[model samples]
Target: MAVQSLQAAPVPVTAAGRRRDREAMIAFWLFMSPMLLGLIVFTFVPIVWGFLLSFSRAQNTVSVGDFIGFQNYVDVLRDREFRRSLITILVFTAFIVPLTYAASLGLAMLVNGVNWGRGIFRTAFFIPTAISYVVASLIWRMSLFNGIPSGVANIAIYEWFGIENPINWIAGTDPPWYWLVLVTVRLWLQVGFYMIIFIAGLQEIPRSLYEAAWVDGARSGWTTFRDITLPMLRNTTIAVMLLLFINAFQAFDEFFNVLGGTAATQGNRGLARPPLVYLYQVAFQDADYGRGSAGAFILTAIIITVTVVQGRLFGFGRSA
Candidate 1:
């Protein structure tokens, strides 16, 4: 009888197994209920709504309006100001990304060397990042580079070389001066963040690699960096570049607060106005919601495209 029982076919328990799976699934859903609900209510819903609104001519006061089809996109693309804004944003990103990356790398290398007071130096470097962009903008506009003799720049210039005229750093009509000022401010505000990233990357690198390089008669700093440091920091460099590019594209508070607008400056274009600021003026000041939404979508597309291109160029996200 025991042999017969052993040889007997197993009783069908597929239904029981199915029931157990159902119960597990129910429990999982219950556990994930809150997050799922939040995603539906906050993220998915808003994205769907915004996408819908992009096709419609909705005023800021009201949520719904007449469907406008491709008119908004057509208008934005046709507008000269929008084109100019896009160019301006591209230029800003181009200038700031390289400058920020270079400065951050330099600062990271410097701070990574110092054994004494390294913590203090690191904290000081990163303190500006802790401040809000608006606060930093205001401080720079009023105190540091205030385009006056009493400003810090002026004081430095005077103290160092006894220069008579304090240069108006922010009030230049030419592209070069404006570009310089914009890059300087952006570098000052952002270098610390990238420096921290680079520092973290630097720390992750194995000391053994450096020792091995030294053992191989790599005495030059440049050789060590090229062979040891750069290869190890490839990922960090890509990350910093991506972030810097995005931030440069979205720059608004500094440009808006520091230079005001072309209207306020009496047709004096302040170096350049980025796409976000241009969209703001179009949407709020000019009451052109459709065009603004179109411009925003285009800007988003540009950012995505540029990021993808950069990733491809640098081979980011590949197995290191």
Candidate 2:
């Protein structure tokens, strides 16, 4: 009998502790109620309404008419403008997402390594995120890429480099130089926001991993980055890419303002009219609300389908 003694099991939580937790949970939900209410009322309600309206034969989006089944969806599917708009968005996304991802990551790496004035650099980069698409487009259109020979871009290429002809950036469709104007402004506006996100992700990675790699005779910086840093940033990269995809799909303000000019004097929208712009024209301008709503749902489906496929491929929610 070698001092056979039974060890006590783990102590149960006190009633007071349980009560405190319950109270804390109540307080949390109480605080969250307002935000939840707002989301339901403003966002969810409108979404549900829009879905319903898509199936209806509504002339103006607000006033609902008789239900027309899937006719509206069928019409929008057959519409050439809608199909073209989808292709334009795909083209835009192909250009913008990769450029933004590379730019932001490079910027983040640079900012992270800076020995001094890091805050200043971060602030300077992030400042552009606060600028509205409307304002940025105006600056690009009215000053930078105004298409005139005296414009900033024209002056840079023609005067500084002594090029014979100033390129008509906006109006020129042959070379598709207008893409430069759109892409540049979007990059300037959004890169800072994504860069900050990358910086946060970079900071979250453990310094010990680099030290361990170094101890294991990994002398090359690029090797350490490839093996440790990139692998560690899987989640952040997935999130950033997903957001980039969604935002790219939602692009409208800059396109409309820069290309079309003012509301009173709309430009040639036939060139690069995205789905949102097409929907806007259909809904508000043309008052074909049912078709517009159908287009909206179609676009939503495309976004959702892409997101689901990507999430699956990336193993977004799975354990590492």
User: Highest lDDT: which candidate?
Assistant: 2
Under the 3 Å rule for N, CA and C atoms, how many clashes does model 1 have? 0
lDDT tens string, model 1, 1-320? Answer: 88887795864679897897789999999999999999999988876666666778866632746888988888888988878888888788777888888888999999998999999989999987877777776677678877789999889999999997887777755434556656677688888988999999999999999898788888849998998899999999988888888888888877876665446552435357778888888778787676677778888899899899989999989978
Question: Lowest summed lDDT over 10 consecutive residues: which window, candidate 1?
Answer: 261-270
- The regions of model 2 sitting more than 4 angstroms off are 1-30, 261-264
Identify the candidate with maximal TM-score: 2
Clashes of each: 0, 0
Candidate RMSDs in order: 6.8, 5.0
Expressed as tens digits, the lDDT of each residue in 111-198 for candidate 2 is 9999999999999999999999999999998899987888999999986789868788887898988899999999999999999999
Scored by CA lDDT, what does every candidate get? 0.80, 0.90
TM-score of each: 0.84, 0.89
